[model samples]
Target: KLQMTREEVLHDIAELTSYAKEHYSTVLFSAEDATRSDLNFLIKANQIAVENGATRINIPDTVGTITPNAFGYIVRKNYEALPKNVRIAVHCHNDFGLAVANTIAGFENGASEAQTTIIGLGERAGNASFEETAMSLYALYRIPMNINTRKIFPTAKLIESYCGGKIKIGRLQPLIGQNAFAHESGIHAHGMIKHARVYEPITPELIGIRRSDEVEQIVKQSIKLGKHTGGHALKAKLEDLGIHPTNEQFQKIFNHVKSFGDKGHEVMEEDFLAIVKDVMGELPEEEQYVKIDELTVLTGSVTPTSTVRLKIKNNGDQIEKTASSIGVGPVDASMKAIVKCFEPMSKVKLLEYNIDAITGGTDALGHVSIELMDLETNQIVQSSATHEDIVMSSVLALLKGLNKIMKDKNSKN
Candidate 1:
């Protein structure tokens, strides 16, 4: 399949490198599937390239099956056999979750450069993750890499946007995942309360996760009270929120959280706050930041359109606004109209709206879940509501998410 013999391949390398040297000041050569290729031939191919003027030789673990020890040996052999003037680079693939380890091994063995893709994008199995590898070298190995460490989170987000939903990075992914710094276990939360570094390998600030100026904000987000939560964990999180309660109030909240978690629900941040406020008698109707006066939508064989009357509180000053917009459906129209009144809100953009019918019938109750994200800070909030009218349900869930974002934003000021 190569379409050429060994002698012909070396001849082509010589011709290509010689020809490219005239125009390009730098010439890099790579032997495809070098790890699996015959070592002598690969070395000879690379030697011929350098003799003809190649400045760099890239060794690729094309099949992604090479072990770290084997990869280190290959890099070392190539580093020793190849001319001292040329730089050696390793291109590893994560077929076995060893791309990061292999790339680091190359550095530890002698390879001068690392070839990686953001989020480890590549064919089939991904290549070495630039963020993971660079962070490992910078943080774990203490290798002072020349990159703006703070931009790691944003750059990954930009790449995700470019992917356009094709490649979604899970929240549990290291370094950039939402839960990477989130502590969910009772013991982990207790340890985190004592010292961040006790559970977190690094501080959130090292990766630009400063969502608030208050340490309590950071602490509250990190400790997720869930099924594994204990009384101590609950107390720690409540104290972070500055909520001091009577023993009875504390017992009531604790039982509620345990019961909720017992039913397989990992209570979210907004839901947790609602629970605390309800128990504290602070859940006044007036506490709602935005309220809908009225919402009307017209559809059925026409452009789906809606209009709304809304009263929103801006810094304790009630403001009334009315607006209308057209959408693909009545639900979309109604939600947009509601969002219009809360216009000039924060950069919290609607990410997703999902609905599931709990029963199979025309009058089946539908549960709606909505996610809103602050584009600037990438903070996400989720809310849900169940109702017979799906449109109203979506609006309620979206508003809940928006209210959470508003409360969080306002808390900072």
Candidate 2:
């Protein structure tokens, strides 16, 4: 408050300085709401503080009402008016979401120190954020500090948890959000895959954060296949998954992706991977066996029943066979029926079956995995299939296992 005249304020400052000199080697004087104060009074107040042996003077934007330009001007004015030895510091609030900007402006204009809080936690909106301030200084302004940046994300996470989820770091938050280093658009992901700096301003490791295999998995999973998707991006994505397709196979996959895009369907990573598996599973006529021609299942209070028609090809000759079976469940019945169609060659036992939902919703993608043991050769193989239909996933998983077993047998012969 300007209730006291400038003379009274100076007198109080002189007394405080005399008292501080007796015990302390350094003193810091903070002028609250200095930004809103009259420029002449603010300058006089700071000068009085400095003249009274204050080693440092802090100008706080208590109400956070100053713009970057104004804050810079104020800092420069105070620096020129204060004693040469007195250091100037800035403490800014984020009421207008300009705290970081104002703080940086002050720094560029000769403020030696910036007062910030972790995750910008403070009264009202909060103070300038530590991560944002420190990162901006180092990355944007080329001003280095003694901060250990690698601990930034982990520290923010710890504080967030301690605050009971109040300190929410948004996905697009500059340095530490989940999507800060994540790429979703095909063009961006492709460029990022080739050269990370293309899309990312800085490497995650610069802040002591390491990108794990899960990061790549998430990037691949979040690929938004649409009109914006590029064939190069799709090819890069497949290669990232270690699945290299021939040019012909890639053209087919690319066409399929475009067809889905044309139909306004966004292809998910799981869906794309499923498509790749389906295409790669195709083989020459002689090598193809255990193909599902048609399948029908009936389930009710009575025992579940399934009828399967399979087309088996051996030595370039194809024959279709139909079989029916019953089980405690529809999936079990389907597997039984499929095995029955193979007769002597179907001497395989289902060792284990597992199903997981890949996505959430009524139309969620389902993944089914099965382990099968060929009794004749005692060869155990595992295979998995993903589809929107759980029943079809189970059947496809079993078929894949059977095909693997047949291939193994043929190789042995």
Q: Give me the overall lDDT of model 1.
A: 0.80
User: Candidate 1's residue-wise lDDT over 202-256, tens digit each?
Assistant: 7766766764323475566667766788777788778877899888778878876
Candidate 1 TM-score to native: 0.67
Which candidate leads the pack in lDDT? 2
Q: What is the C-alpha RMSD of each candidate to the true structure, in Å?
A: 14.8, 6.7
Please state the error at residue 226 of candidate 2 in Å.
Answer: 9.1
The lDDT values for all models are 0.80, 0.80
Give the Å error, residue 389, model 2: 6.4
- So what's the TM-score on candidate 2? 0.65
**Candidate 1, after superposition: displacement of residue 75 in Å?**
0.5
